[model samples]
Target chain A: MNGDLTVSAASKDTLPTVFGYIGIGVAFGIVGKAAGLSPLLVTLMSIITYAGSAQFVIVSMLVTHSPIFSIIFSVFLVNSRMILMSTTLASYFKRESMVKNILVGTLLTDESFALGMNKLNYSDNHLNFAWFNTANVISYMTWILSSLVGAVLGNFISNPEKFGLDFALVAMFIGLLYLQLISDKSINFNLQLIVVGFVLVAIYFGLIFIPSSLLILLVTLVACSFGVVMKHAFF
Target chain B: MPSFNFVLLTIVGTGVVTWLSRITPFVLLKKFQLSKGVVEFLSFVPIAIMSALWFENLFVQHIGHLPSIDWANLLASLPTVLSAVISKNLLVIVVVGVISLGVTRLMMGM
Candidate 1:
């Protein structure tokens, strides 16, 4: 009975995270179409690319008729973060079979990482691999299908911009960030405020010196390192 | 440069890069264990990167000038943020943000 209850509770926590990926996936699809990519191309990108920010950047480049080499470089730069994500997972997956590890690595995304990391927190077992794979598959299917739907129907809609569908992506990220904020409730409000201020400053400066993707990486690393150092020093 | 060839090259190029970024770490780390400090630093990378990305989108202009305060993006972001705070469900927040932006744009004669 206790085992069953635990399983049920775990599923409850994970189910919403899975569904969130679906919604995010759909939003990506809609936005991809608005950016002028074809449905087939959008689907292929979702399947092949899997990283949301990279996909968005790719579509933006496509709409602007960027050269092929530029698009490739931009995608490479945007996805550089995945190297960190996969590396972290490597430590936890030391015991898993090679095939399983490769499959999971291919499906790694922010949502999948969150779910997998949360599960890893509770158990020392390898079964978290299965859960991670399951969540990724669910998220992947939702993203692909929703993107296909958006691509096919996107043309009929005369004005997606008017409806503010573009804001969907922003709102989704905000919601995800809110969750991160709440999880670390002990964080000082004053420090949080300062971090926000610094991010804005970074954004202003980042626009001048670097591409948006790299700017994000640079600011995040600097700010987060500061936050971590402060936390250790003070608390 | 045929379109079909362009598509094929994109797929292959992206695939190769993606696979290498993901696979290389595992292969290298398999032989050597990561130090505690390294692990701790890596754990924070995602949150930092995501924040930077989100902040950039919220503030930067995609096309010409930064979108005006009167732009659909600014007008729509208001409701979208509200919906996210209230619902906390991805679908609800997305639908609300998109629909609200659309309706507001129509009303504003944009």
Candidate 2:
């Protein structure tokens, strides 16, 4: 332990995540507050759930007074990717104690998971629970605080798009995809990934009745299968 | 407005379900040994999920409806994607995207 002062790898690695979370969190807060949710409630949801897309679903479903069970189910389906993420991450942890895994898993979100996995996939860094936990805590605080700010200032901003915050996450994901694609040496062109992704996108467009969350899950499943099947068939 | 109790239940219920999804894999993987084929299949999940999310944001306006050629998003994304491919820096990509989107919105009087 550092008797003086030192920055951990988790904190350093999560700096980008802090920025990403803040943008999305404020957007969530503004939308929640605009939908008539109390600021305190919005903040509490951020603290407790800490899931970005699911929180948005909660706010919309609340406005419509959708059935509670259905809301939970939708959130579960949307977040099912967390399972795959955690599975991928489990191999990186130095020691996976029950308590450590529980605490670390509690803080898992898509962005942090993606960033951490990218680091693990490309580099030889020794990822520990402390690193993942630190990223988690920083990201958690960023989201809660930003969402609170958004909720408090929700009345002041009528159109979030005027500031161009709406496109923030899309830009972040594009950057991430680029990073992942360049790091891999085996594959030159992502023709297979792009083809599979576009095919699923077309299906999603055609089947409007299916829930987007469920559609994402199905797309992932089918695409992975297709990728594996093609790999087996050709090579 | 819905009662406080109802909102609380919704939030708590949501938190529980979400946490369960996050935790279940870590807990269960301790006991189970996944097959080699399964791991290989799982490797592609990240790219798949990321692409699905990116397309959803770009091509879909509402959850159920197709986007009617979101010119602003499209135009902004061009430079943004170019920056990502060329610079490969997160900050640069994000800045280019936001500035481009802002400029497009201004030019279109959005």
Candidate 3:
């Protein structure tokens, strides 16, 4: 770990995330356009919403003419995970000013949050505000711009599937999941990974009955609690 | 065309909900002290959440049924997962996965 990698240099580390965002953003744009949304409208939605999955859900609901209340409810349900993520990230930004933290928190997406946390974990510095903000800002910009491009060219590429853009976000998530694993020599780390995997798979199976958002929230709480209990009892 | 008011409401409503979710914890947790046990356990949240997301996307189709395996995605993910294990680089993983899926789609003539 080079201690000399300044915050600016660390910001460049988000370039890969930038690519992932653009891919997913374009997919969203294409879908939005196909759903009869104007390019300007979708771009505005991206700017304000800034959430990929939620935007996708919103667009699909719009197409179906679902009630606005349900659209709002579904987006909230999908994005409720942000609450957990924000809480985790809050502990890290304890020293920063409230305004800056709020600004940074608005741009939090799953990829950016995971990558930002990973960088912080591996780095020696206490908290590199510039690096974290740069990563978030770049990710947000890339997503908005790419989505606008996709909406504009929505007519050109009738099938985003032929290009396999749908898999980009999933691939990115897989990479992120791989990155989150700590390669330490601790047995507890491995045990935690196994527990998380087991819990997630169980939740997946449980989805047949439990609503996905509620199930995921329940699983997170239970899994985290189990981790606490296990650490206290054994580790 | 959908009514303009409905569209506007959709955007504004979604924005409000999204912002509220993101802001609540930042406001509530800032002045509070969290327990060590809780923080330690929260470390695993990312892995748990990401796994749920990746698997849900790869496997699940809809509500109230078993996730039928999509062979194209499954076959394509094989190389992608292998590359992910080998290289923690996001670019490498995405390129490998996209190309793998593209070739599979081509062969299957879908």
Q: Is candidate 1 or candidate 3 better by TM-score?
A: 3
Worst 10 residues of 2 chain A by lDDT: A1-10
Fnat of each prediction? 0.47, 0.58, 0.60
Q: Flag the better candidate by TM-score, 1 or 2.
A: 2
Between candidates 1 and 2, which one is better according to DockQ?
2
Question: Number of clashes in every candidate structure?
Answer: 3, 0, 0
Tens digit per residue, CA lDDT, model 2, A1-235: 1111124755666675566677778888899989998999999999887789889988888889899899889888988878878887766552668788878788898777767656654455346676678778898999999999999889898567787776777777777776766664433346455544664565456446566777777777777777777667764
Positional deviation of residue B95's Cα in model 2 after best superposition, in angstroms: 2.2
lDDT of 1 by residue, A1-235 (tens): 0112144444454455544455456666777677766677778877876666677676776667678787778777777767877887887777877777888788777666654544443454233456666666776777788778777777775454554655555555555555544443346655555565676666666676566666665776677676667656775
Candidate 1 lDDT over B1-110, as tens digits, reads 22545755665677667667777786777678998767656655544554555567655444433422335655666776687677755557657766776787788887
What is the full ranking by DockQ, best candidate first? 3, 2, 1
Candidate 2 C-alpha lDDT tens digits along B23-93: 88887776677788888787676677666766666554455565446678878889989999888777778
Pairs of residues at least 3 apart in sequence or in different chains that clash in candidate 2? none
Every candidate's DockQ is: 0.43, 0.59, 0.64
Query: Global CA lDDT of candidate 1, please?
Result: 0.64
The DockQ-derived docking category for candidate 3 is medium
Q: After superposing candidate 1 on the true structure, give the runs of residues whose Cα lies further than 4 Å from its correct spot.
A: A1-38, A60-65, A115-127, A185-197, B62-109
